[model samples]
Target: MPSAAARPWRARWRIEASPVQVLAALLVLAFLLAFLVVPVGRVFVVAFTGAEGGFTLVHFGDFFRTSLFIESFWNSLYVAAMSVVVASLIAVPLAVILARHRFPGAALITTLGVLPLVMPPFVGAVAMQLVFGRNGTVNLLLMDWFGFRIPLMEGLNGVIFVQALHYFPFILMNLTASLSNIDVAMEEAGQNLGAKGFTLLRTIVLPLALPGYLAGASLVFVKVFDDLATPLLLNVTNMLAPQAYLRVTSVGLGDPMGYVISVILVVVSVIAMAGAALILRGRDFATQQRGGGGLARRPLSPLGKALAWSFVIPVLLLVLAPHVGILLLSLATVWSFSPLPDGFTLAHYATVLRETPQFLTNTLLYCGLAGAIDVVIGVVIAWLVLRTKLPGRKLLDLMAMSALAVPGLVLGIGILRTYFDVKMPDGASLATSWIMLTIVYAVRRLPYALRAATAALQQVHRSLEEAAENLGAGKTTTLTRIVVPLMAGGLAAAFVTSFATAAVELSATLVLATRDVDAPLSYGIYVFMQSAAGRGPGAALGVIAVLTVAVCTYAAHRIAERERSRRMREGRATA
Candidate 1:
């Protein structure tokens, strides 16, 4: 439909890729097709196919007819919805306090708010049981004083409590970013129209941040819905993810119910994502413009500050309870039927270090390899999409990002079902091999690395690469010598992000790790926590996992900050 003049202009923009570029793209596509697409497709195929290999809905019918499956489906929906509500309640006030008000220890509070995220929700579930369960420290004190107790960690309530505490940072981070970017002019305009305080916030501030809130809320819903370890750890199996896990593990992989549940999880995730997109359609929430600033932070009055502290301190304590409980548990020699530990020692840590050093080594090896694979694939995909003229480049990006919708448990099931029979030359099935865990980790964490790589590539001006081309540099040379060096910081950060997250990943690890020696720290923690005697070492392992993730997170931040500062300095120098 373009005119002749426009045709040439468009053609000029589309540069033909070199043979090397073509090959790279093909390799990446093959990897995704084999590992990501085929496995998930196999799950759908199996779910729909009857034992006679004919298309049928019997599996789905069986799923619906079963009372337990029905209860699990509803329980998952209820827990996910309630978790969003509770997480929103916790995150919104804190986001407002941090973004809209100036107060002492605000930075510290903000830092502590994100602490829960570094610890996995499953790990925290046990710690929470110690602190808030019926026989827990708080309940013990309550019964002694008032002769009554609250069922905070009983059944589904425990899952919700642990998940809300662990995952609220998603809402907090997104809403805080949204609130900080809101233009102050809107608030002033609302004040001019006789709106004040909560009225102004209700009318202007909250609506402007709805996009971010919805984004976070949808993420929380999907995560809670897809979570496998948390509910299982809490001894609550009447949930979709846990049921899928249980069926696959206990009932054997041949059962169609697991795949059916996986299909439902995939559907719910897709619907939740699509619903959020639908709600946000055609609505522009962009308030900041050039030279504009965020909402002005007002200094808190003494009474206002006191009220804020009273709210924030308790929330922080409650959120941080898992970390505290885990630490005390790791040190406690005997901590039962009491408010505090009877005694403390370092024997548990010593025992973990002496007995299960393989968990640490396996975590390092698997996560390291996965991170490397992610960065390489991410860079290639970013280049093909942004720089080269490749067909279906956007599709490649979409396929990689689609992993976000695939729950780890679902992915694990798919991987097992798809590859359980495919034996390697070593005479072992590919599904049970440790390499499969690494591959799954790479697939699960690809989206983050791809976004990082794309952002990094975008920041490098094309003129620099063009100059290299002008000087007889080929695409390969230019990328290796110029593009990659510039992107080193971002790529390193991407690797760290991938490594840290993959270290704590348990859903796929649960499905793929068939033996004790091949399992990572996450599975080791799960194994240890199943009995009371192993709780000490499990808590110690949990602490180590938390520390590992925290350090990696800090390193990534520092790398990003240093790179940003360098870029700023370069801009100033050029100017």
Candidate 2:
């Protein structure tokens, strides 16, 4: 037998690493497997496994045989592609202006442009419907003024219009992020060499911001392709998501049509991600040098100002018109055969307040849980990859980023597939569980929180972490007391943003929500919009969603301000 001292060293050698650290890693791995891997795996099994224990591709074959399925798939592709193109064109110019100029209303414009980022895509659809639908404000105004009828908003065109309006800001924000890194001196030098306005933009700005445009376009493509609500709401039958939903509910659950659509969606997402990877390589301005980024503003001439406003006004009107319509509808007792409401009433608002309390409560609970999970996972994963010398650091980084490419629908399907039959071995069905929805929301939103946390951690010097460790503070203590508090603003922002989104999420919720459950606010709105009486209730719920996001955004901003103040005070004290 070894001596006691020798036995202690032997025990230490037997361990691969610290039990605490190993346990932590194992916990994370197990969580991923249970929540993500298994759920997605079940989808394939349920789709293919026969009674005789054999596999078949009957589902895929059956799906291809249906013309409706094929038509919808192609329609989805067309609509999404158009959204991608339109978003890129509009966003690129806005990004250029935001990056190059310090205008009077820059902040306001940027905020408005990014408003949709935090809001659900369907909210934009609701807004657009109020403005562009038959008997909508725009059509009503046009009919009254010109005494002529024109079908500007309906079918595929209406879907595309709404999607473009909703997602253009994605392109703008990304392009702005990219252009901020390009040396202004380079553009000034080009101008010095006699390059005029259009030519200068074409040669200099376009080439530099191409990667950002591509990144933004890739994201838009993925979003529009996976989206179900906009197309369904706008009466576009030729779309992928709606077809999938129909196959599951209207056709039959046993039909392979749903699997086929899911497979097609996965393929499309992969292609879009590939395109993003190719176009966005080495073009991240966030990783570039931070200092020396002061853009000199050149005042636009009267003619140039006129041109700018011309571009700005149309989009502003398009964006605001929907909200105006919604506002009018909310106030008016009736909406048809009248330019304005027949009578003003608060009945809709009051009625919604009385009903749907369960939906509101459930939405808050699920979102809050999901947001907390995301913050915890995000911070832990970020700390592991950035602060440690791990074996699969690059792989971890890639996995975290991979969530960006995985659409919400894909993730939802994955969750359903993996956990449909999961239990504690005591006979429990995880398939219809609220816990599953909460987990799905958490992991689906993980990438957003992770990215924000990573950015915040990057801003903090590693030496500070090291300093804390060297001072004899344990890893947990250091992380909790120092790193976490310092990164609180980013963590809080991520949580609140994720919460806002979860509260309004739809397509996946439709698949997962049970009859007894209140479902999310999205489902509630969808149910309301399906009928005439429901429209008033739906609009009221939509307003609630908007208010929810507005509150969360305000909270995030306040947290950021508090953190800033705290940092400044600490800095002065140290000095």
Candidate 3:
């Protein structure tokens, strides 16, 4: 330790003395804005500028005055708000129960709850259609068994229903994490002081969990609001995402009006991000964290047991129903007015494989590139924030997190505005190019990898790194030999997640893809669903996307599990 006399000038010896660190920092910040911020800002510029480069508010005027656009914007907000409220109501109690108690298949249940997140939104849309559409499974069973039917899938209601089912898990997962950190000792004290049941919950549990609950709510709200594919797939024509797509594709407005809508979505997202920052201000979650321990379980009374089982069964069904429907549809030979398919076959998959090799190759290449780019930039950004004393460290953190709010459609449009017309000296252009897609995917997925890397770095103590340096290891050697190996699991997790998300990215890909190459599975599904014999092929492609994501997510989970087990074994051996 430095003496008091030398303390003021004795710096922390930040990990930034070398050219490598400086270069990495500069590359990361440039890449981040190039893909994330600059393109986003371009939306505003394109929206307000004339063809001759003059400025006007005609785009905004058109957006507000047009009946279709105004209605869609309002509808999008309405659906998002309602979905958040309903999902939160269901998720909060379920999260509390899961966090506070243990039961059979607890791990499986938790995984199942989060499974929807890995599946693409379009898959959810297809699945919900099979389960809840007119003459769908639910209606068919009811009509056949009891001569009764219920209208379940139509209009905004259908969109909200599916969204709520798919996103409730998001709220539940976040809430579970939040609630698990609440101190049980406080509840124990209250109980010992004559507080019981509802009273104890209201005064002790609820107050402590409010911040987390709100955080979950905010996350779910933003997720629901920003989602475009789900609403489109569910046939909600009057939604902002589809509306923006129409403006760019159908209305022949090019990107000016599209940019206006994208700007609005971005503004809304910024508000949500601000709310999250305010909720979490100055709170060190790691320090305040508590374990979900010491809660004793007792056999429930008969009726109580019945109620518990009832709740569990329906939630399980709700979560599983869409997936089951999609899987069945993917394999179905035909499904017109049939309770079940008349036959099952792999014909759809075969047809797609034979007819569209480009889809497979394009998706793999783009997703792979995007995933690689995301991991590299994410690691660099994490290092800059954690290992180096960058000038704008806090601002970088905020910017990274803030990307979560920018809708994918909005981001895609931003990319178009920024690089569509830029020419290279050799006559190559950036617009709709493979490199551009990779960059967009990288920047859009950066937050996930950055967050993962940051967390992973935190786990491997800095002292070990410093010790390596003191023992004659160079900075690069120390990082490569010690830090990278230690954080391999987290990096792999981030890579797999980024890959899965990129594979299924629709809104952004739609903007970037051309007929020749770069059109991914999501874009293909969207195109096929518009043709005759399209539903089957679309469902088939949806299954493929879902399976791809599932495989990657599963790989990530397995890697994480293996690493955790190894660490525990090593700890035991050391002890």
Model 2: residues with Cα > 4 Å off, grouped in runs: 1-16, 44-58, 280-295, 393-397, 421-429, 459-472, 561-575
Tens-digit per-residue lDDT, 238-267, candidate 3? 987777776776764365777788788778
Span of 10 residues, lowest total lDDT, candidate 3: 287-296
The CA lDDT of each predicted structure is 0.94, 0.73, 0.77
Q: How far is candidate 3 from the true structure (C-alpha RMSD, Å)?
A: 4.2
Those runs of model 3 whose alpha carbons end farther than 4 Å from true positions after fitting are 1-16, 48-58, 145-148, 192-195, 252-255, 276-298, 423-429, 570-575
Clashes of 1: 0
Q: After superposition, how far is residue 339 of candidate 2 from its true place, in Å?
A: 3.1
Query: Cα lDDT for residue 480, model 3?
Result: 80
User: How do all the candidates rank in terms of TM-score, highest first?
Assistant: 1, 3, 2
lDDT by residue (286-342, candidate 1, tens digit) is 875537699889999999999999999999899789999999999999999999999
Candidates, ranked, lDDT: 1, 3, 2
Error of 1 at 420 (Å): 0.8
lDDT of 2 by residue, 1-575 (tens): 78889988887656443455556656666776676655545555656655466897776777778888788878888989998887776777677666766555678777777766555667667667666777777678888898765565678878888788888887887788778777777677788999968898888767876777777788788888988777777667678888777776576546555656776786788898797787657764332333675344566677766766677667667666666665666666776655666788888888766777767888899899999998887887787777765455446556656666555665666565555567745465575577777877887787888888987787677788889999998878888999998897888888987898778778778777765364777788877777766677777777778779879988888877887788789889989
